[model samples]
Target chain A: MVGIEPRVTSYLDYATGGFTTQYAAMLVAAGVCDTVACVFGANPRQATVGDSGAYVYDPTYGLVNAGAIAALGWTRYMSKYETVEEDLGAVAVTFRRHARLNPNSAFTEPLTLDDYLATPYTVWPFRELDICKVTAGGAALIITAADRAGDHPKAPVYIGAAGRQQAPLELAGDEHLMCYAMTSVAEQVYREAGIGPGDVDLLMATDSSTAAVIHTLENYGFCEPGGGGRFVREGGIALDGEIPMNPDGGQLSGGYLLGWLHQVEAVRQLRGECGERQVAGARIAQYATTGRWRTDFLSTIYVAE
Target chain B: MPDSVDIRANEANEAFEAFVGDHELRVQQCDGCGRRRLPPSWICPHCLAEEYEWIAASGTGVIHSFIWYLRPLDPAFLATPYNVTIVELAEGPRLISKVVGVQPGDLSVGQAVEAAFEDGPPGATTLVFRVRETADGAEG
Candidate 1:
């Protein structure tokens, strides 16, 4: 991807985690091409997902399926039993602060916890600040042969391990869907990398919604289940925390690139390009996302050269 | 009994349509394991069996969770700012529905609720939830 641009670019609806890494790998896996560009751009005409025009979770379209509403509602219910809402509020505040360091970011204005609480709930638990922004911009990443992935970049980061998993999307099966398909992907990547969660320097975590971030924090083995709320509340996943999660502001404040943008942030961090937001001597990073199906999730880790 | 009407049920949901049209709430039950499932799916998770049968639900449940909407995101839902709840059916399956005859604040975890069908958009008979009252042989 450094020397030449990929000629063939395919169209993918930027909802869930469909477009970014999954499609890129899909293009390569099909054996049709060795390299392809995964590009996502949003504007008025030809509406993209996450935009106000494309928030079509109606019966006609299928993002908010039968189990989705229940999953979200259950998250909200459990959040009330715990301080997860406070954790969500803290993610908004932390990421907005991180956005200040990201000039390419949308909504760079600093936010406070009071501001987050005052924001009206779009859905019951997910407030305006709890979700990603309806952004209009383009993010592209070229997937090429690893051998040819050298030249032009500041410093190249290698794709250490990649893993994905899809789970059944029915409400009748599980009591709750706190983490989506994260556990399967986590196991795959950790095994591939030959390291555990302790070795990860930072996670360019994808927070499609604030509640999702808390769930991922717990279910992804960053902490034990029911520990996510406490982890966020205590600043354990903050900018300079023990795990240093979502250093790029994630989707909460980073503007929804459907989560591909978090990888760009990961690459930049690994290359030591981020000025104020960079984790010190950060050698390893994890970028993860969930697909259109509520339970189809993927995670890819990167190692700095 | 709030003016129930028929909906535009899809082919995959024909079995469900027929049952609900008869005013009976039901789900696909695994013939092998007797486990109930939503979405009227073909396969059973427990027994890995392909064959299934429909079983009538108790029409009674608890409000497992809920959310209040303030927008007409769905034009079909005439009631704006409505409350949607995930009801845990007494038979052990769950379904996404709304709670009528109650406001958002009145909802709580593990509250007893019963099912009620209503006339919904697209001519679909939408299943709804309502607060179940205790019978003490006296009026509150």
Candidate 2:
């Protein structure tokens, strides 16, 4: 932060959904500024569950983001492939389990596959467990040049690569349901980082819905498209599996700080500061987010240095 | 529909609203590329052509995707377990609307659907879809 003195020469504000931290880091890398502070806060608790209820009513269509995502999830995955409830439930259950180890997480209780399945569907094909809890909070990140990092007390996580893409016209076309934009961004970031899915030790994905976790894995090439359901169900994303995802519990069980928390967790994981939930010998960490209604997608690779 | 006056309409979508008011379904057809797009836009996405015309749709399509809400996200939605569907028009564009004349469990992808309209608040009318009847007179 430039502080009350206002010594900073330039200021850039991002109202553009998630990926705030990554974009801020990019500014530092580009020499736009020696340091940048990215701040985020959301208080959608009342609006999401309250009087307005996150539903956007056009003259004819009454649409909610959660409901639309649920429909898209089923349309994209279940319609074409043979998938079970466990395929989707695994994401919620695993996140809650990881949350049990995260002291900062509000959702401390253990969630089993059965418990997830028992939850009622607020929207068909999406249980209450599948959606994120609307919480009010603030998160901030201080991104500085690599040379400045040596002055800090804590180990710095270097930004290896960053990529973001906005879907054409926000909500037009089938890209939102199909993860076409997500794949494009993921490929760009992975290439820039000179690594594949196998090289990353941890993945912190913004899980606004369980369906998002499944889609993220597929879009990032962690697994084949349409195979995410089976991969997650088979424990590929578990803590001891091939790739540990959302070790700090992600948005499903972690507080939904509009994806800022994922960046925070990714940095912390690469720094090896997480206590019980930490992945041993972690080097490369990946953080990703698909913006509200899948309108945009972003990925960043962070490595311990 | 909730009457909060929060309708998201502008110059780009005005043509669609006028057609639905007249109980007809139409989409924007690019004059240069012979392609169609909906939720009405000024330029063709495929060709970036500025000139376009509104042409009547066949009013027939297949159920592309759908979902049923167990509870209304907005209080104005009167019924429970109501379905919202996206219909992929035969002319090659998708529209978000509701499908009537069938139960939620019975509705499936690829079912034949045709355009239907309902009166909305004031001058506006809502565009919806219904399952087309099969040759034997059964609901499609």
TM for every model, in the order presented, reads: 0.84, 0.90
After superposition, which runs of candidate 1 have C-alpha atoms over 4 Å from their true positions?
Answer: A1-10, A13-34, A45-81, A172-176, B1-12, B42-51, B71-78, B119-124, B135-140
Best by DockQ: 2
In candidate 2, how many Å is residue A240 off? 0.8
Chain A vs. true chain A, TM-score per model, equals 0.84, 0.90
Q: Model 2, range B1-140, lDDT digits (tens) per residue?
A: 76332333255577788888899999889898998888787667788887888899999998887777776556676567877788889998988898887676877778899999998676678899999998999867
lDDT of 2 by residue, A1-305 (tens): 53444324343343432466666676777877787777777677462343211546353566665545545556646777778889879888888888888988857777888888788776677777777776666777788998898898888888898888888753325578765688888888889999999999999887877888888888889998879888988888888888999988888787777677888888888888899999888899988887656767888888999
Candidate 2 deviant stretches above 4 angstroms:
A1-18, A42-59, A170-172, B1-12, B75-78, B120-122, B138-140
Q: Which tens-of-lDDT digit does each residue in A208-298 have in candidate 1?
A: 6666677777767988777777788788877789888777777766667667688888888898988988899899998877655345677
**Against the true structure, what is model 2's DockQ?**
0.45
Per-chain TM-score (chain B), model 2:
0.86
Worst 10 residues of 2 chain A by lDDT: A45-54
Clashing pairs in 2: none
